[model samples]
Target: MSPEPTVEQLIAAARAGATGDDELALLDAVIAVTKDLSSHADEAVDQVVRQVRAAGHSWTVIGERLGVSRQAARQRYADRVERIREAAATGSVIHGRDLESSLSSALAAARADGLAEAGTEHLLLGLLTDGVAAATLEQLGATRDKIREASHRLFEHPTDWPGGGVPVFSAEAEAALAAARQLANERTPDCAPIIVNTPQLLAVIATNPGSRARRVLNHLGVDVADIKRLLHCYINVPRTPFGRRSRRGRGGKKQRDRCSFCGHPRSEERRLVAGPDVWICAECVALCAEMLAQPADGGV
Candidate 1:
């Protein structure tokens, strides 16, 4: 029936060791839970900071924690982080607590499915949840069917061997997805969807080294540069073309080069000319007559 102790009274009691053992145990439990929650909160904070930094945060702070100079951390993680962030931010709401939960769930799912490092397909699953990034992906035509197909190709093909040959997820891959989720979540309405463009998609597949996804993407004639650009914009990172130095002079100077199929800069790898002024890429030529065979929009 007595009134509860006031703040000053409680302070005085604590100083005097006047609290009962049962009350102290309860307080200790509460303190323990608080510490656990604080630990979790710290992890969440670290994840967000790491994601943003990967998208191109300077290393002065990152280095200070690692006991290294800013330049050292930058050199160590700049490209690796940028690539990981780019991959993750592709049209998904993957940030803050949402990103952490999604990534943790994804890793769990991959493990349950007996998969190695979390792939793009796994990332797609993370995006299936109801969120801003998922909405963006849906709006931009990233359907479950396409994702499933992509995943199948990535997992089944002999060429799609994951790096390191480890059965567990790679830290890099997980971090990439986390960064991407954060970037996707952070995007504004005016931002474009981070769907990989044809060329860019092709490049991702190709650069995957031995990934089946890379092979499939290449077969589809997607562009690597476009995919990278989409990812860069989505992740809010500076866009820098990979292998730009190698691509230089691989095809002659830009002005003189002509597309064999259309006489434009965007050349199809395979070309055919049915007649003069009837040039087309092999795929286009095959589809041309079928498209022409269809009734016009205004036809009865």
Candidate 2:
């Protein structure tokens, strides 16, 4: 697929399309794209700051790098960084890179609309930012533009706040994130920090019946249950005996057992049932059974 248009490209396109009568619309488009650019810049900073902090660098060092005083650096990012730390500290949840990017996109979407809080709809939009969630949504016929339009139509937008502070995640958005962390944690081995990925976040958001995100997805004719099942199947690959620790098979040869039908590797949740020179995961078996259960006249 072609790369998304850059902010400059979008702005040029907007200017080119402007007619005298539609100057206001053109201006709005410029504002939107610029806000997107700003949001991306902020996200980049946030990610880098988090990484620097994680590397045990002090705020003083960070401030020096950014050409600011330590106090100023702390004042600007302390709350956001601390909030993220607190959330992960509780469950030992680590945000994967894609999750972080998706969240940044979600926050950007909310900020672009001048919302005071990023809610479930924003989370849904964030899930489409990239990664497995984006691919899954695409397969289900939900595009970013479609979701954005439906969200704008179905959701209410509050007036822009007086100050241009970064928007906080709404309670529902926080809960959804927390739920995703828990789900990831559940699938992990004991004592290992759980890394929340985009698929996990998307699954939690899609499964929440009362969430605006789920409502928007439903509005676009995407089935939440199907999403849940599909994500589960993707996540629940059968675990190999090696189990991410050992690469060597018998006699120091590397071996990997995967589902013959679906080709998914082994995972904790889904076990493989072995056959002669082949293997099948539980998910694929269940899928095959379901397909076979259908009547001949009713195609799978």
Q: Which candidate is the best by lDDT?
A: 2
Residue 163: error of model 1 in Å?
Answer: 23
Regions more than 4 Å wrong, model 1: 1-95, 130-136, 157-168, 171-233, 237-300
lDDT of 2: 0.65
lDDT of 2 at 39: 25
Flag clash pairs in model 2: 237-267, 238-266, 238-267, 239-266, 239-267
TM-score of each: 0.29, 0.52
lDDT of 2 by residue, 40-124 (tens): 2343354346645776778887776566899998998887666555654565676766678989999999998779899989988
Q: lDDT per residue, candidate 1, 109-201, as tens digits?
A: 455445666654454455444333343345445555665566665565334445343344455454444444333333322232232211222
Model 1 score (lDDT): 0.39
Q: Which residues of candidate 2, in runs, are more than 4 Å off?
A: 1-91, 159-163, 237-300
Q: lDDT score, residue 177, model 1?
A: 44
What's the residue-level lDDT of 138 in candidate 1? 50
